[model samples]
Target: MDEIPIFIAILSFIVMCIGEILAYYSISLKYRYEFEAISFGFIFGVATLILIPKSFFEGFEIFVVFGMIVVYLIEKYLAYCPLSRKYCIECDNLEEVIKIKFIYPISFFIHTFIDGLIIAVSYISNIGLPLYFAILLHKLPAGFVLMSPLKGVYKNPLYPGVIVSFGTVLGTVIGLITLKNISPKILLAFSGGIFLGAFLMLVPHIYEHKKEKSFLYLLIGYILVMVITLIQ
Candidate 1:
């Protein structure tokens, strides 16, 4: 079975923690739009430069679409669910409140879990370094996104960070256990789809709210990713 190196695992965990810490301290409602725009750009760049190319070369393009559809449906469900409420809101029913509160944190956990799986699988497949870099590059923005909604809701903001971190560890373990059966290409494609779907969902709202500034930031974010890719 393929295994992630101890150092790599540790480094990934540290980077994720750093992102969470930064978000906990720095993210605010005032700059939420800008943050979302940059996040969209980062995910776009990752999809374009890393995930799509890798998946296309391996003939797994269909899985990308499937992944996107999955996220779209999931987002729709979250949006329209009767039990759904904003993170900071209070619901009269305890069960419904718990369910509503957990929606985003659960999603964050799943996403980061896949991230861990991808990192482990990619490393085993010999494409670890760049993919790892790409994943690491986005961790900060991802942390912000994860924390933004849950920041004031949770008395200890560390809760969501711990959830995501646990997800990553579990994913790495699962990847190691299933290494022989899974294909990295398909995983990459699916992850790309999720990223694209998320970008599509988020960037539009940001564009509507911030117009030109959002566009400029989005472009800057994408360019930053490209520059990093070239450097790598």
Candidate 2:
């Protein structure tokens, strides 16, 4: 067989790609889900760093930026068909929501990059292969969870969304390169910055619609996922 880490590392991408399909199928399976799927993608970044060795942080940091682009593309597909100017019910008025209105169509791309790193880190972590496996198991759920938000933003099915998830390959390649030349302490500090950016961007979303039980739970899960990621 192939070298284990090398193999697992590469395999991670395949698992992620398959996950998107699995996620889409889940809706057909009829699970009650919120549109806030991108949130999981962000949390994945934080968790990836936490579980992996401190040394891998720099590699992880670079992977996140690239991965965000992947998420943006996915959102592009979801928003492309543009169904109703009316599905946006979360906000009190269109006037206030309009400022960030441009973001949803592509923001999901950012979310996936975070998710890619999260999956990558599990492979890198003290959680070991089993933890990695556990993470891969959630890939489908993640796909579906993420898809929910895009569905609401645009009634169109996610075509680019499928393409964007392919970024898992780019994410893995860059991360592997970082593995060869980065110092752990520096990486940790860098990771802190990345997570901070993602956290700041997402925290408000979680707080904005605090009324939804599912979203409230997602935030709790988000924080919990982050907490699990810190130095564990």
Best by lDDT: 1
Q: Candidate 1 residues 1-232, lDDT tens each?
A: 2444434555666766766777788644456567657757877887888777877754577888887887777666643233332222222343353553577677667767766776766666566565566556556555655565466568887776767766766777777667746676777787788778767766755666678698888887788778877886
Q: Using TM-score as the measure, which candidate wins?
A: 1
Could you estimate the TM-score for every candidate?
Answer: 0.70, 0.48
TM-score of 1: 0.70
TM match of model 2 to true structure = 0.48
> Candidate 1 — which residues are off by over 4 angstroms?
1-12, 15-36, 57-59, 79-96, 148-157, 228-232
lDDT of 2 by residue, 50-153 (tens): 42345353356565454444433443443222321212334443323332334442444444444444444434433444334433444454455445445444
Candidate 2, superposed: residue stretches over 4 Å from native: 1-107, 117-142, 145-158, 212-232
Give residue 161's lDDT in candidate 1 (0 to 100).
Answer: 77
Error of 2 at 49 (Å): 10
Clashes of each: 0, 6
